[model samples]
Target: MGQGPSVIDQATFKEMGLLSWAIIDLAINWGGWAVSAALQTDKFYDMLGTGSFLTLALGSMAAAKVSHARKYLVSAMVALWAVRLGAFLVARVWKVGHDSRFDEAKKQPFKFWIFWTMQAAWVFITLSPLLLLNTASAGGPARIVWSDGVGVALYAIGLIIEATADAQKFAFKMDPANKGRFIDTGLWSYSRFPNYFGEMTLWWGIFITCTSGLSGAQFVSVASPLFVMALLFFVSGIPLQDAQAKRRWGDIPEYQEYRKRTNLLVPVPKSLFCGASCGPKSQ
Candidate 1:
């Protein structure tokens, strides 16, 4: 079937303005916390955090005067990613019974609320590009472009890499023989945080696809991937994990060696001949 032309008009724009979307998105985030706080469990946070993105994306699509196939495709991608991540995180937290990250925060109402607000901000920044594209009164059905293909390829690669790394790590943790040992095999051999690399790549790909539909003020949506990268690198993902790993295994010669040989965030093939003592000293 042929793709339809864009149908966004002045009336549609007025009805689904950026501010309205932001308010709705933030409301969903804050609302999720009510259930979490009432139950006194943070296990639901992941599901709600991810579900918010899908909710907002679908909401925007529904608000559009004429939804194009591109809109549907982008929305589907966001939903797919969100569902996978949400399910994985929810399963993880459920299995663990509690998230240590919230142990202290949950005890203080204000601190807990701040964390929920941060989740709201995270959802807003990470999905900014998709949000803009979905709500914009832009051109006709998205034509397949080189960037689209490249973006899709990057996204697929990222998803596979992330899933693989998570599976490998989970399996390693489950093995009694691997107890107290760091995972330095499979994708982990290439980077200390291969999964994070994948996560960042996924957002970058999504941002690229957003560029296909965005214009003018919407260009500011580039912040989507940029924010994801920043959060993963300096703020939440890498820094925390790195610190935890170091605290757990800093004295182990092997882990120190592994740290020296492995890239911090980018994947690269490990040298086959590196000795236990060959790499640089730990920082």
Candidate 2:
């Protein structure tokens, strides 16, 4: 019903995001430690904090060698990406003050507990790769490999693309004229969620780099990418955004038309037809 700059300020958005993360972290960190201690071992290593553990794990496996540089590189790159995404989300949450989804659920005690607790679980599980890499590993070759070069290059490209896409979206939203409109410009034009695509690719590159040095358990670390994809697609990324879009533009004939033509997650060419399969028809 409204089309204008959000009344919500940036500071409030940041606070909401940070508070959500903080609440989730509190539940995971303390709950995880308690559970692990009771179990007498870190049985649920996957449930530890974010992928900071992956950093430590990779470092341990690499040991003190030339290849150790590769682990450090991977760790540094991932840390940067995580911090950047976290900060961005925090800013967005602050801008919105409180997420409507959270607010709605807050009225129901069971739903509130479950939602926040599950988010904490998701955060921990999703961050396994980084956490493992951060933990003390045996260390690796004291020289970098050709694989490291490729990994670094891929990661750099992914980060650049993701960062650019995010910036473009932010700038588009900041422009008052574009209020309540979808962004289909720059990298966004190429892919509906270029940022997410890049982020998913970045983790794969990191995983490849981390696994390049080893044989057994290292290969199993594919879980990191898998977890990220699941969370992004099903939990944090598209579904939530889509729901918001539907709420905002459900009554707009133009938006309904756009939704039919534009790709939901992956970027694709606009369709010429406006059939049921294409999506809800424009009024």
Candidate 3:
């Protein structure tokens, strides 16, 4: 019988694959960074993130000759998410004229560079599952499994939650009566940061989808969801938004009351989780 492939060969392939992907991340993010920093503008910063996701997903599929239905499934989910979120951000930024998040950061060289690099890291880590899936040695098409169905269902639920919340918020903002008011109705009533929750949920769905094709070390791609959770909970997403919310609505009694009652991430009703506090205030 012929000898099995050496451990050295496998390790080499893995390192090379990761290096290639890193190169792609840098090319997209840093390249965009150079332009944005030079122009002193952030109009396209969010687009860069989405563009990186789409570029790498499709490009990796092409590069690897990925014909497996499982791989295509992963790529398609990524494409759908990247496009939807990207379009929303682009439109919102255009309407608002500028992103408050980048106001000072874009002016400082180190801060701006960190923004791009961190974004690259975010893209690489978030796309790890799909990247690993597509780059793996293909064994032809795969049959749809229970896991795939579950993944698709979770993805659908998350996407709907995120899209609906965004649309609802947009409508509320458009109403002249809501000029200075915070959104506390619809999905916002369920969770203070339902969009973030939805974002995390959808990524977990992608991770689960990739599991059908992942094994051994490849399973480390679970970092996709974990990194997102950490970013939102600890690092960037929730913390920044929460701070901004506090600055804007902290002094309002209604906002403070809502904050005290609302779940921070999950959409569970306060009444379900709280006993007496969730009850209506006494007159």
Candidate 3 local Cα displacement, residue 141, angstroms: 7.6
Q: Residues 1-283, candidate 3, lDDT per residue (tens digit)?
A: 2435666555554444766987988899999899999988999799999999998887676656446888877898999999999999899989889998899988987799899999999999999988888888872338888888888888888888888888889889879999989999999998999998899899989888888888889888998999999999999889998998999999999999999889987777877888788888899
lDDT of 2 by residue, 1-283 (tens): 2533343443333233223434546556556545544543332323244433333333333333233555577767766776676566556556545445555454554555565466565554554444444332433455777766777777787788788888899889879999878886887664667788788778777776666555566455678778878878999787887788788887988776666566655544544333456555578
What TM-score, computed on C-alpha atoms, does each candidate reach? 0.88, 0.65, 0.90
TM-score for candidate 1, please give it: 0.88
Which regions in candidate 1 have their CA more than 4 angstroms from the true location? 1-14, 139-141, 270-283
- Candidates by lDDT, descending order: 3, 1, 2
lDDT of 2 at 160: 81
Best by TM-score: 3
Model 3, backbone clash pairs (residues 3+ apart or across chains), number: 0
RMSD of each: 5.5, 14.6, 5.7
Q: Per TM-score, what order, best first?
A: 3, 1, 2
Q: Candidate 1 has which clashing residue pairs, if any? A: 6-140
Question: On a 0 to 100 scale, what is the lDDT of residue 273 in model 1?
Answer: 44
**Cα error of candidate 1 at position 182, Å:** 1.6
TM-score of 3: 0.90
